[model samples]
Target: MADLSLEQADIIGRVALERARAGNSQPLTVVVLDAGGHVKLARREDGSGIARFDIAHGKAWGALGMGISSRGLAARAAKMGTFFTALAAVTEGRMVPVPGGVLIRDGGNRIIGAVGISGDTSDVDEACAVAGIEAAGLAADIEER
Candidate 1:
């Protein structure tokens, strides 16, 4: 699968930050992952915590690995918290079921990977993530958002 370009990732970060600004969210952290759930790009704006990167990456990775939005995973987890906890353990603590991450689909609606954003409320984070995906001319599905 063709990987998301760094240029595209940069644009995604920029768009997300701009959207967050419009929404009154503080500094943000944005991460993009490839189809294999590998980091393609990560950006943390000034004042964003270093831990934000881990949160963003975890959300993106979880979405890609489960082939669903993090919000959907969170919903499923809400019904089985222990299972979701075990999943995090199985992933070596890299997976997180949250509302801030979304799968990225190409023009054909094929899953290409995901984008994650953190440093705000889950709803705001999701908004930034969705904005990034849409700005990249891709589709984002957050069934449980």
Candidate 2:
């Protein structure tokens, strides 16, 4: 499996921030997590609330831990309701079943990590992640599966 290196993490963070700005979205906090759910990098831009960083981290951590994109989790949450809430509780509130978390994959389609962005609409945040992964010559698991 490919590892999320510091250089790649930096590229992902920078691209996400730039995409957020280009789209005229709110300032964003982007968080990248390795396959083990450890934080590779986290960044909150100026004008973004501090909470965004935590939220973004939660999303990415949740995705890495659960082995699914947060968007998929969100959809599952909608159907599962309190069970999903309980999952958040069970995971110590690290499981953010929201739309911003996305799995990152290498060329062989192995899950390498995840990226999460906050401080804008969830859709916009997800877009930035997808863009960043593509820009880095990687792939988003959402697109693959």
Candidate 3:
């Protein structure tokens, strides 16, 4: 069983909001998912663009589905463009090979779910996402899965 819970999701969202505020940028959208890729929680900060939420969700979903961080996916996509592109189509465009998503892991490095943030550059978004996961006391790899 996974250790992920709604409380952790809330913590992640709060941390993301804090990071976004610290950066003095637009509001961010945060999403958290369970091991099975089900949404555990999602928050759309006020003034965030509507599209931001979808991007955040896609990142989180992709992380959970791949059992790895979205950053890893992006790297692989760069090496295998055609295959990754086809995967996006097969996933109905839900699988996004972009940064801003990090897979949550337990103390033993067991995958739990993922957290994703949007409303900034891909790098900034990914940093915020990783920050939130760290704030929630979850283990996550910033560069690799």
Candidate maximizing TM-score: 2
Q: What is the lDDT of residue 61 in candidate 2?
A: 87
For model 3, residues 1-145, the per-residue Cα lDDT tens digits are 4569898889888887898889886788888888888888898888889898788888888887777788888988889999988888899988877998888888888888888888888888888888888998888665654
Q: lDDT of each model, Cα atoms only?
A: 0.87, 0.86, 0.84
List the pairs of residues colliding in candidate 2.
Answer: none
Q: How accurate is candidate 1 locally (lDDT)?
A: 0.87
Model 2 per-residue lDDT tens digits across residues 1-145:
6588878988888898888889999889999998888888888888999689889998888888778899988888888898988988898998887888999989887899999899888899999988887888888875312
C-alpha RMSD of each candidate structure in angstroms: 1.6, 1.5, 1.5
Native-referenced Cα lDDT, model 3:
0.84
Sort by TM-score, best first: what order?
2, 1, 3
Best by lDDT: 1
What is the full ranking by lDDT, best candidate first?
1, 2, 3
Say which prediction, candidate 1 or candidate 3, comes out ahead on TM-score: 1
| Model 1, position 107: C-alpha lDDT score | 77
- What are the TM-scores, per candidate, against the unseen true structure? 0.94, 0.94, 0.92
Clash-forming residue pairs, model 1: none
